[model samples]
Target: MSNLSGKTAIAGIGATEFSKDSGRSELQLAAESILAALTDAGLTPADVDGLVTYTMEKNPEVEVARALGMGDIKYFGRVNFGGGAPGAVVLQAAMAVATGVADVVVCYRAFNERSGRRFGAGVQDRGTEPSAENAGYAWYTPHGLVTPAQWAAMAGRRYMHDSGATTEALGAVAVAARRHAATNPKAWFYERPITLEDHAESRWIAEPLRLLDCCQESDGAQALVIVSAERARDLPQKPAIIKAAAQGISGSTAMMTAYYGDDIGHLTEMTLVADQLWADAQLTPADIPTAIIYDHFTPYVLMQLESFGFCGRGEAKDFVRDGNVELGGRLPINTHGGQLGEAYIHGMNGVAEGVRQIRGTAVNQVADVQNTVVTGGAGVPTSGLILGADR
Candidate 1:
């Protein structure tokens, strides 16, 4: 079993209201969420000895620590891969706590993606920056695979052709998310649910990809507190144990455009992550009571279900259509409305929602939610986590 499993727990989670525009600096959002999380945990800033966040996050560790009036930090780090780093942040913090390197570690992500730099618009001019990373984009941007939606469209279409999954199958995922979002008071799309028919009628951002199938860009921040399970029990809230957390990158991966693979339709990186997480947690997909599969795009949600062994190859469409992913189904998914219905804070908010399920405080709570499998972005090197109720 993984040494880190069951050693650390999420003591608190906090986020500002999800919105299209926050009208505040990303740094301010990060600071406010961090403070809110600390307050929720009944722990002061002085208790924080470590910090973790996404490399894509605008606010640095020192800045957040200083702003929160936290004392000297003993450990601080950041994970990369765009929206795929949220769960990995928890993993890093859990390791630190388990190793006695820190007592309280905060994982956070904050951005003004909608109001500031819109990632969906795709790359423009980075001014001749010479880097191996930028070079990868050069190969596709020229052919108009500029936006994330476009890059996802290629793989999505190939999956549909290979698996015989229809656009209606993809619409099921959107309908489920919006259904949950309609009941969530904090969701930007609260009280607004979508139907599968609506998903079909929505205009295609990319062929075979409807506007509702793509996640909305939003401005917000989310933060979580990681501490030892022993300390967490003494906190105000019930702890969501970190059963397992992992990040994976398959060979020859090139961001979301790893088309050189034998199968452009497969998400090998997420499969690799799934292998590690199940092994580390000593559990299987059958053990999970609910899921928060990263829904940056609906097609990816299907691919993730397959990669994680929730269903047989090319059977995710049938699996979801059977109502297994809906609330009160076999596996209630994205109980917080997901990035599609909820604001997309680069999957940080998904992690927070996972904690809520474990705490039994979810707006759409699943009965006896003993385990929740939460995934980060797919179509690239990604990360995942298995959070369980304290044993």
Candidate 2:
């Protein structure tokens, strides 16, 4: 456990409308989301003295600040590992606020990921200039492992082998997410729930992963405003206290080709995140009544449940076997839909959902919710949050 835990809170969250195409520049979207977050916190851009964002996002922090006409930024940072970086953005902001490096920090990610560059479409061409980073991806890229589905299929197939989970189990995850999404107007799949059969029939992106198994390529941005827990109480909204914020990278971690580990089906990075979160927050899986696990891929959702000790290893298939993840189930997930149903903003939307859940303002609010979990991208160097309602 660390002193940083429970010291700060996410005071507000804001986002641009999710869509297939924003028809706007990424920078403009970044500015819009920041302004929205500031307003949501009942503050102006001048109140933000720190900024954190994804390294992969095209928008730069200084540029975004200038666009928003912000005050002098005392702290600025960029986190890596694609979607895995979202939680880290909040972690950075929380750390800054806790240490007084900055009084207020806004963490954001914005992009035209769908219309501009679809990550689902896979690697087209990496420029000649490369480094140690590309070497890991290079090992499998030449062997038909260029796409995320392809990489996930290798991992999912191994999971089924070790856990006896069938492709149908993966479909069940997609079904639960879509069912939640059906009622969420912000979800891309809102009012369009599917069945196990629909998942079976959907075209395959990879052998083990169907089109429904993968998440949507969305265009949008999400931002969160963070301040000291003391400061949050005086703000205009209820505070979602940051019980814990942690990031991890297992020894066996790779970009997406994390195939060197003893168990290919497991998300060890998430496990690492879980250990720190639970200890730092002084809580357990049983304490969390709601969750917003990343659903970029359905199988990873199952692995996350296991990694977080919600279920034993190789038991997630059974854990999610029924309608356990749907509304009114033991663990209702992605109430705003998910990356699969909601427009994917690289997991930032998931964190915002966590804030909403703690604030009791979620569109699909869970009953008597107290503690909530928000996980980042599962396969890469990841992060997570344990958010609780202020006592």
Candidate 3:
């Protein structure tokens, strides 16, 4: 629906190995991934004129440019909302390229989340800083709503209550992701596939969320090179055209603890993203052969399916239970293993997998993936993308 559609494409993708410890700085990881992407695109550092990353990323754009000896950057930007930012970075880069603001833009994210700082540790000791985001934490922190799992558990419980989904439904998502991951040599959980019984036996991180339900805390970086569709056609790799990109924030809510909303079980922000993606791309759920649904938590995966209209509201449990989300299924999702089975690079890895699917080079490659829908984290301000084969 906008001029940006089909104007730019992700020409190449690259990433550092997913691990719990990188034994390197986040800046090194960023630089390595960017260089790898440039090489994959048959380009060089001097070709880069724009950079985009998450606001939470410690590596600054200037530092990364310096590390790679890149040219003078004409455009540089940062996106917010933690896990919600993976797609937003690409959106910024695509806009910059489509508008003639930059010729080649690289979007990247790198962190030492597992070894350096674990987000699962929750709020430890905070400085006496006052901000709007911190202010929201005050309301729930006193009530022991600290970690991500705790917040997700509340929503998972409500979803099960309203939809009649048992804990087994959540386990199904984990099981499917692990099955995909078991074969993906790049996945952290490769050869570690789990079953429904394994999920049931895993220790509970929260009431409804088990250890398997949570995504791994990984340390790595992923980068994608974006350029005008015309330029991308000349590149070495098949370009994953950006058919649509959108970000959304619906109800007044905090990061993951938006229990004050009318319904804690639904993700309205993701619904808004879905509506925009379908409308902007002039496509429907049936048009997408596969998807890389963000799996920060298992329940949110189900919520995303319903929000994206892949299934009716509260029908995701039955849909996933019926084996609709596995390889060779009706709508196989997260063929790269997902955050649950693959290492969680904060959903950036999922986007790369979408590109791989479009290129028909994925490990668990689907049959006819003309288009792949990739979504960011739910339960927060989120984003989504529709990547299609160049027609």
Leading candidate by lDDT: 3
* lDDT of candidate model 1 versus the reference: 0.90
Candidate 1 Cα errors over 4 Å, as ranges: none
Off by over 4 Å in 2: none
Ranking by lDDT: 3, 1, 2
Relative to the true structure, candidate 2 has a C-alpha RMSD (angstroms) of 0.9
Estimate, for each residue in 205-234, the C-alpha lDDT of model 3 and write its tens digit: 998888999999999999999999999999
Q: RMSD per prediction, one decimal?
A: 1.1, 0.9, 0.9
Task: Give the Cα lDDT of each candidate.
Answer: 0.90, 0.89, 0.91
What lDDT score goes with residue 75 in model 2?
98
The weakest ten consecutive residues by lDDT in model 2 span 124-133
lDDT of 1 at 370: 92
Residue 130 Cα positional deviation in candidate 2, in Å, after optimal superposition: 4.4
Sliding window of 10 residues with minimal summed lDDT for model 1: 123-132
TM per candidate comes to: 0.98, 0.98, 0.98
